[model samples]
Target: MNLFRLSKGFITEVHRLFALFWWESSDVEKRLHWGSWDKLCESKNDGGLGFCDLSLFNQAMLAKHCWRFIKWPNSLVVRVIKGRYFPTSDFLHATKCSSDSFVWKSFMWGRELIEAGSRWQIGNRSSTLIYEDRWIPRRHSFKVQSPRVLGRDAKVRLLLNTSAKEVEAILSIPTGSNLDDYLLWHFEKDGNYSLKSGYKLG
Candidate 1:
């Protein structure tokens, strides 16, 4: 007894590829309802049926790991985890990380999709990571008495090189820009940004 039957779409595709085998089967066994596919793919709790969506599940699990790396980039444990499971590619490589050497590639491939500004959530629940967005004016304390009055080009240069600590301080002023945009620009230009000790999550 075939307790579980294949979905109609799957059956149709299989039959197309194995027409000879299908044709040889009895006519009574070949019949299948089109509605059965949707029912079989629905969750058991929903009352329609029980079927696993392999592709969606894979994407969800990969997204979880992507969250992990962003939160703990410098952890020795993270490195070990990547090295053992994904040894060859860089941590941000765009390939899937099934083995020890592919972690970096996996991260690279999915990084943009799970960016800090994205509104994606875990398991269709609350937001996965908390973040704030703001724009900040550029300034150099040692060179200029009133850095905010500096020209746009000068401001950009100042903000780009300013340490995170200084940026945090200037951000406190009621200015045209906030810290969020400054951080985003810094990361975009430099490819890396440092988070203050308190800003890092455990």
Candidate 2:
């Protein structure tokens, strides 16, 4: 279904199945509803059953596709999408072409989740623009608004070492021959997205 965004009607129909089980009813008959479905969807702390709202869960699941595309560019699906829609750039900066497919648009809708959890892991720094990309942990971008900011054209590649073995951003600009930087997800050790993590993000 992720080939396109699921329609509201489809989601509601799926929810109908859940509602049948929820109220201890069947498709053929009604049963007593102990509480509103919205209340059942609320967190336990909110005095409800903590079921994830299905609509939001659906979106989060779809957003997982976006997360996967960002972190796993080596995958076949990523390769296809990259070639088709974003050959010139990485997923983070990819803009839609007029020829975007339904799935690409569906994936694009989930881009915000990718932005929320990703930070550039500085490597060659070629793709990252200094002060423009978020790299320095905790601060959004370099946080340097001063007109006195150093070397306006600087890139993340400046943070590499002469040995090209380690980062050297402390006393001088890092310089390296590496050709690309990468996205790192803040929540996972492997930087992989899972349904559980996506739920947390939701």
Candidate 3:
């Protein structure tokens, strides 16, 4: 499940089996379900059994690999995957190919989770795309809220250094550092990914 994305049918069947097991139902007989499957899958605090949503769990599992790719970009495994899958681009911007392997596809699927929770921690080199990347450290979305204030290809450094009209929000962000900018897991205080956080985000 961590290495490959399971088909919906398979996950559905697993959910069915889980439901039957919890309800003490037999394979040959159907039983009355007291609550909807969704209700049963809710977190314990929400008053359900906190049963794992298999699809989301699977996605979370797969996302661990994606997290690894980002956290260890220079590792041998990441190097091999990048060389074959996204030689010119980073994992977040990699495009899909029809001929890509199932493992790569699963990794790509997992990348969505990372994309959702990731933000850039601006350093001296503010090369992040102003409209394309999330770096503003704001609630809701870190990307610029205004529509097309700057050129599509503009970088974040432009806002910090120049007198751009729509830069009040950008000006609030602190900049100028000695190190390179890096990705951060916005949900975690330590700026790292965890399976639990991934599952919630999933």
Candidate 4:
């Protein structure tokens, strides 16, 4: 299967191959399908053949690519994409360009899946934004972004004072000079990705 699905058009070669294999009779003539292709793409428990939907599978795979990009931002592939589409904004906050490459557009399509399943795993608060990133377990930082509540330069480090005390903060994780903030999959512990989770999301 192509890594990028329908990046330019409606269907991919994999789908075309599937149609040929499933609907064509011996050598030449096409056979009448016993059931609708959509129905056949459902789960066996749902009274269908349990065939995998190529489109959904493709989306799931693309989403994993986005996840990998975010998980390892310094990778060559991510560096290229980020350099072009999101020089100022991070992956989750990046806006779609009017004239994006087909692959870049495809990358945009799968980004939401990664965003929905991921959260910041705070090792230290350095990279996290006090008002922007989701360092808190239940939700992202402060619900409101009022100037009166927090100054413009506010950061995750602001939660702790010089005394190393919690200054109106709920988090109490220990900080170190070498610690760095990282991402984790909210659905599971030990931070692993699963195709079942991705397909279920689709």
TM-score of each: 0.31, 0.64, 0.88, 0.60
Model 2: residues >4 Å from true position, as ranges? 25-35, 45-47, 97-99, 122-131, 136-181
Rank by TM-score (best first) = 3, 2, 4, 1
Error of 2 at 45 (Å): 4.9
lDDT of 3 by residue, 1-202 (tens): 8999999999899888898988889878888899989998888988987889988888889988998888899999999989999999888888999999999999888989888878888887557787888886654576766666678888767753433443665666566686778888878889898889889877
The lDDT, on a scale of 0 to 1, for candidate 4 is 0.66
Clashing pairs in 2: 125-157, 158-174, 159-174, 160-174, 160-175
Cα deviation of 148 in candidate 1 (Å)? 21
Best by TM-score: 3
Write model 1 residue lDDT over 1-202, tens digit each, in one string: 0112234576556534444343454445664444454455566666755444433333334544565665576688778766754567544443453452444444443344344322211122121211221223232221222324434334232333444555554445343432332122122233232321101110
Write one digit per residue (lDDT tens) for candidate 2, span 10-94.
Answer: 8778777787987889967899888887788777877988876766676667778887787678999899878988898988789
Q: With candidate 4 superimposed using the best TM-score fit, by how many Å does residue 25's alpha carbon deviate from the native?
A: 4.4
Worst 10 residues of 3 by lDDT: 160-169
Candidate 4 per-residue C-alpha lDDT over 93-126 given as tens digits, one digit per residue, 9 for 90 to 100: 8899779887777777777666666667677677
User: In model 4, which runs have C-alpha deviations exceeding 4 angstroms?
Assistant: 7-20, 23-32, 119-182, 187-189
